[model samples]
Target: MTIQAAFTLIINTLGPLQGNREAANIAHIVIEHITGMGRMDRVIYKDKLLSPAQEEQLQQALNALLKHEPVQYVTGKAWFYGLEFTVNRNVLIPRPETEELVEWIVKDTHTPVKILDIGTGSGAIPIALKKDLPAATVWSVDVSAGALEVASQNATQLNLNVHFEQIDILDTTATHSLPLFDIIVSNPPYICESEQKDMEEQVIAYEPRIALFVPDNDALLFYRQIGLLAKEKLVPGGLLYFEINEAFGKEVVALLEKQGFKNVILKQDLYTKDRMVRGEN
Candidate 1:
């Protein structure tokens, strides 16, 4: 089938499930991924026929998408902070708000400094930070061995030296061996179990649940642990950053303050939702 024909089929088939705008966006992403042709190139080859192999690949991807699998996982790649990284069901897909948090750290950082990232899913946080701030020594830790594997592969592919370790941050004793850091950053699992219903079906069905949720009654679990640990791991004047749930921005800020963090700031993302927070040790 011609590229144009296949593209329309994808849009029409998915339009009923996903909204028209989102279906079209997914169509564009899948088309580019399969054909390796950017927007202008795809337009130039609109009438180009997809080879048999390409057709089969398209069908497989469509089936997965019909099941609400994320397009990034479907393509095995996701872009963050201008770099493409491998992704799978083992890790959560990177999002734009996290990029803003990274930018916040990079803006405050200069010279060689020790940095640690908690919950290193896809290693996107540390990898992007390392790419931008080459002088910083970055280390990342996650509880899931599968997640660490994916993060390590990304760091290697990006040709960035980031130390990856397996540690459950929830276990305070497991972090004792970690060295002190000038900056500690985390985009921990802040969504309450009750909030899962509000999230997209693709996210709930295909994304790693361990990386996305916390018990509803203990929604601040990661933030509180990471904050307390940051107090121990961060050098004096070191900064701790988090991407928080909008519903509990004030609560997170209060939690950091209670942890003895000074100059705590609760910042909002582009959408003006309270999404990012930072505190000084």
Candidate 2:
């Protein structure tokens, strides 16, 4: 099959499910990853024929997309904060909004500081911070050993030194012995279970639920626990950053304040959603 033919097939198959623009983007990404052809190559070689193996691979990727699988998971890779990281069903795919959280942390501190990321998932936040702040000592904690494994691999592949630990922050006893940090950041599971119906099928069905959701009655479960832990773990006048549920920004800010954190502030993402909160110890 010709490159254009395969491309058209991919669009026709996934366009209705993912919308035309996104389907086209996923098609290009799949093609680029598989063939390793640059964007210009897709334009110049539109009519070029794909070998039998290339056609088969493209078809397989298209099949996954047709099932509403995220392209990042289908390709086993995700881009975040100007770097690529490996991803799978075990980890939540990194989002652009989280990049804003990382950027905020990077901009807030200039000198060497100890940093810890709660519910690290794919290790995107810590890895990006370490890359930009090489002198910072970064540590990441997650409950799932599988997720920690993926995060650890990403740290190694990115050549960023970050310590990974499997610990459930919800169990305060588990984190009692962990060392204090200069800055603590988390993009924890803030999505309430009731909100799952409103999410994309691809995310709810494929992404790791433990990393994406909280009980409706306890929407701030992770944030609440992390906030408490930060109270004990942060140095005097240290910083706490959270990529919060937009709906609960004020609540999260309040939670931190109640924990004795001061200078609490809420910030919006590029989309202008109240998606981040910061506080000082």
Candidate 3:
């Protein structure tokens, strides 16, 4: 089949699943992955023919997209900040909002600081921070060994030195051995169970639920636990950052303040939702 023909098939098949523009983008990405052709090369070869094997691979990708699987999972790669990281069912796909959280950290602090990232799925936080702040001592911890494996691979591939450890932040006992930090950041599981209905099927079905949710009655579970831990682990004047649920931004800020954190502040993302919070020890 010709490249044009296969591209048409992909768009027509996946347009209903994603919008037309996104469908076209995914189709181009799949073709690029198969052909190894750059963007301009693909455009110039739009009329070129594809081998039987190439057609089969594109068909399989189309089938997965039709099933509501995320394209990052389909491709096993996701772009965050300025780098691409490997992703799988074990970790949550890094989102642009979380990149903003990383940018805030990079912007607020100078180098030669100790940093800890809680729930470091895909190691996006620590990896990005380490890349931008080359002198910072960065460490990340997660509960899932599988997720840590992916994070470790990403750290090695990016050639960034980030310490990885397995710790369940919700269990305070497990964090007692952790060292003090000049900055602590987390984009932990802040979504409540009741909010599951509002999430897209691709996320709810394919992404790790352990990285996305908290009990409905205990919506602030991670925030509460991590906040308390920060009070002890953060050095004097240390900073704590969180990408919080918009619904509970004020509540999270209040929780940190009640634990003796000062200068508690809630910030909105590009969408104007209260999505990030910061406090100082």
lDDT of candidate model 1 versus the reference: 0.94
Model 2: worst 10 consecutive residues (lDDT sum): 1-10
Flag regions of model 2 displaced more than 4 Å. none
TM-score of 3: 0.97
* Ranking, lDDT, top scorer first: 1, 3, 2
Better of 2 and 3 by lDDT: 3
Clashes per model (N, Cα, C within 3 A): 0, 0, 0
- How do the residues 192-265 of candidate 3 rate in per-residue lDDT, one tens digit apiece? 99998988999999999999999999999999899989999999999999999999999998899999999998
Highest lDDT against the true fold, candidate: 1
The collision pairs in model 2 are: none
Question: What TM-score goes with each of the models?
Answer: 0.98, 0.97, 0.97
Mark the regions of model 3 whose C-alpha exceeds 4 Å error after superposition.
none
Task: Tell me the tens digit of each residue's lDDT in model 1 across 1-281.
Answer: 99999899999999999888999999999999999999999999999999999999999999999988899999999999999999999999999999999999999987789999999999999999999999999999999999999999999898999999999999988999999999999999988999877788989988899999999889999998999899999999999999999999999999999989999999999999999999999
Encode model 2's per-residue lDDT on 134-237: one tens digit a residue: 99999999999999999999998988999999998888789987998999999998888889878999899999999888899989888888888888999999
Q: In candidate 1, residue 22 scores what lDDT?
A: 91
